[model samples]
Target: MKAAIVPALNSPWEIREVPTPEPSANQVLIKIGASGLCYTDVHITKGAIPTQFPRTLGHEPVGEIVEVGVGVTSRKVGDRVGVPWVQSGCRRCEWCLRGKKMFCQQQIGTGVQTQGSHAEYMLAYADSTMLLPDSISYEQAAPVFCAGYTVWSGLRFADPKPHEKVAILGIGGLGHLAVQYSKAAGFETIAITHSKNKEKLVRDLGADEVVADAEALQKMGGADVILVTGNSYKSASAALKGLRSDGRMVLMGISEEPLEVTGDIITNRSRIIGSMQNGDEYLYEALDYVAKGKVKVISETYSLNDISRVYDRVANGEVRFRAVITDM
Candidate 1:
């Protein structure tokens, strides 16, 4: 099997032939169709996130099951599926027992703890694989496993009711999908971005309003829920000020800097706040939305051999929204 292997931190991925992974007793082997390239992959390559060398870096994946393990009852050969970030969790943990597997003490990410779907073939635990609807193409469903699920989980945390104004901060990968989900879920959606060029794109994604300046945000009179999806603490902090009384802000993007929220604003408004990723339940729900065409993934496709180039694009914010690596 050919794979683009990450040999070392800050080094280019080498296209080489690697052994095809075989399914274990409770796992299934998949012939990867597509894999989404995220900032997480770039972070892993640059050592911003800890990961082992020679690892395949991809979590948002779509593939066809080519081989099923002996005890894999839920899936079989020829089944099309999607794999998400939460690869496995300790089932005995309290968090897992309560259906919050993303918070389990022993959580394993697909690209980090195990080899991922950046290759022609990869392995996944039967329980972790999602059945993809035949209607969704593999290329289109790739980003839904990560960026789509992340935004969906973030919105779920916000718990917006019908007609509530929800603000999406940053119109990048996660934020783009956040706009769509907010619209489909019956919220009055707004997209906030400093880039004037993205205003049309955001509005096209079903955002009721698009704000390119601070004054525009002021005109909207603040939002009931604000979802911050960038790596800037400043942006997150600014969005906090743009929330209505008793409004909440969910931080979804990982930032290297410590976030500073004004104590006065938080206390005075009595805002409920936190960040969340998709648990097993959320993943299933997100996939359903994709199947129903309520949510769509906007991505640029690249070959797996173009890993370094894609990483540079993601680091420099060159990609339109998200980039996916096709294993062709």
Candidate 2:
């Protein structure tokens, strides 16, 4: 089996032939069809996300189940599924017992702490695997595992009202999908970005309006729910200025610096919240939306052998939205 391995911290992806892994009693073995490369992959290579050496670094993987372990009944051979983040939590914990597994401190994170999907074959915990819809291809469904799932979960965290407006900050990978989901839900969607070139693309994705920044969002009568998808905490901090009274700002982006909160962001108990992949219900609905064609993943594809080149492109910030590693 050919797999891309990160030999050490700050190292490039080395394509090597390794023995295929056998699934454990509670797991299933999959023949990976596609994997999405995220900016977090670059951070992993640079040791920004602390990870063990000689690791596989992709969390967004969709493929076919070629084999299943003895104890697995929920999934079987020939099943099409995706191995996503939030694999499992310590089932005994309070959060897990209460059904809020995403809050479990002993949660298992794909790629960051386990063998990821940057390989031809990998073992997945049967319980955490999601059954893929027949209408969505592996390449298109790959990003939904992380980018799509996170933004949608953030929007849910915002809990917008029927007449409230939804605004998306940053028009990159996650933001692009956020705009579509916001519009598809029948809200007046707004996209906030400095890139003049993305106005048409954003509009084409069903953005009802486009704004340059926080100030521009304010002029349009503030948004009831703001989903922040850029890694810049300053941008996220500034975006709070555009949140209407009692509105919620859901931060989906990960940043190194502290997110500053000011008096302007505190009107009528408005909330500043951080969110990631939420409950299973959110992921199920997120996948359904994309499967039904309400959301689209703008992506570029590469062969598994060219995984290193994917890194270079990601480092140069050249990916249109997301990069998928396929047989192409």
Candidate 3:
């Protein structure tokens, strides 16, 4: 099997032939149909998210099951499935016992700590794998595994009231989906960005309004819930000024720099919260929204052989929204 391997930190990615892996008792082997090249993969390549050398880096994978282990009764060969970040966790931990496995201290991250779907075949813990809906294509459903689920989970964390103003920061991969979800959730959806070019695109995605900057947001009386999807700390900090009193700011992007929070951010008892990859229940809900066309993934597709070029495009933020590597 051929896989894209991170030979070492800061080194160029290499496409190498490797031995196939057999699934363990509680795992399933999948023939990957498509994999989402996310910003998180770039972080792994640059060592920002530390991991062992010679690792395979791709967490959002939609594939067909080729083999299942003895203990896997919920899944079988030929099952269509999608794998996310939470590959496996210590079932004995308090968080895992309470059904919040993502918070387990001994969580194993797909692509980060384990062999991921950057390869033609990979092992997915049967319990963590999500059954993909037939109505959604593999390329489109791939991003929902991570980007879609992240924003959906973040919105749930915000818990906005009916008809409250909901603003989406940034207009990239996650931001685009956030716009649609916020609109569907019955909020007066707003897409906030510095780019004038993205206004029409955001509006087309069902945003009730588009604001150019934080100042514009303030003039509109601020948002009740702001979903931060851009990785820029400066932009996120500026966005805090546009949150209404008692509003919530949900951070969904992974940034290297610290967010400068001022006393004003808390004057109204506003909350600054963050969300990680959610459980299977939320992932299914995210997929259902996509399957029903309520939420869509704007994406570009590439062959696995051209993963290096695709990686460069993702790292440089060149992909319009999401980038999926398929034809594997």
Candidate 4:
């Protein structure tokens, strides 16, 4: 099987012929149909995510099951499934018991801790795979495993009211989907972006309005729920000023800079919460929207042999939204 591998830290991606892995007990072998390349792939190459050398870098993947292992009666061969980042964990662990499996000490990350799906075949725990909706294509449903799941889970965790106005603090991969999800779920959506180039694009994605910054958002009327999906803590902090009193703000991005908590957080009792893809139920809801055509995932497709080109465009911030390798 030909797999894309990062030989070492900061090394170029090479398509190498490697032995295909067989599924162990309670696992299944997936013949990857589409694998979505995330920006985190760049971090993995630079050793930021801290994985072993010669790793195949991709987590957002969907494919068909070719074989199932012992104790995997729930799924069978010839079934379609999407493999998520959190493959599985020690169920007896504290985090796993609490349903926050990603934090489990022995948690397996699909691309980071195990062999990823950027190849002809990869192994996945049968319990961890999502049954892809027949209505959604492999390319469209792939990003839902990561980008869509992250944003939708964040939005739902924030718990916006029926009449609440939702604002997205970025308009890139995650934020664009956040905007659509906000609108699809009946919230009046606003896109807060620093990129002048994305204003029109975001509006076309169903954002009720586009604000340049927190101040601009403030002038347009403060939002009841703000979803911070950009990778800038400074931007997230700045957006806090536009949060309505007693509003909720969900943090979904990662940044090195510390977020500044303003006085309004205490005086107005505004809530700030951090979230990742919360649960398998949330993952299904995220996919349901795309399956029903309530959300459109913008992506550029590449052949499996051209996986290196996907990395170059993503690193340069040239992908329109998500990039999927489909010709595997």
Measured against the true structure, the TM-scores of the candidates, in listed sequence, are: 0.94, 0.97, 0.97, 0.97
lDDT of 1 by residue, 1-328 (tens): 9877889878887778988877889999989999888888888888987888888888888999999988989998999998888877899989888877779868888988888778888889998888997888888888988888888988997788776799988888899888998898888998998888887888888998888643577577978888888878777776666777778788888787777667857565746466666565676777777778888888899987787788789879899788988855
lDDT per residue as tens, model 4, 189-254? 999887788888888899999888889888877999999987889888888989988888999877
Cα shift from native, residue 34, model 1 (Å): 0.7
Evaluation by lDDT, superior candidate among 1 and 3: 3
RMSD of each: 1.7, 1.3, 1.1, 1.2
What would the per-residue lDDT of candidate 2 be over residues 237-295, giving only the tens digit for each residue? 88888988888989887789788887765555789888998888888889999999999
Q: Whole-model Cα lDDT per candidate?
A: 0.83, 0.89, 0.89, 0.91
Cα RMSD, model 4? 1.2
lDDT of 4 at 273: 94
Worst ten-residue run, lDDT, model 4? 40-49
Cα deviation at 210, candidate 4, in Å, is 1.1
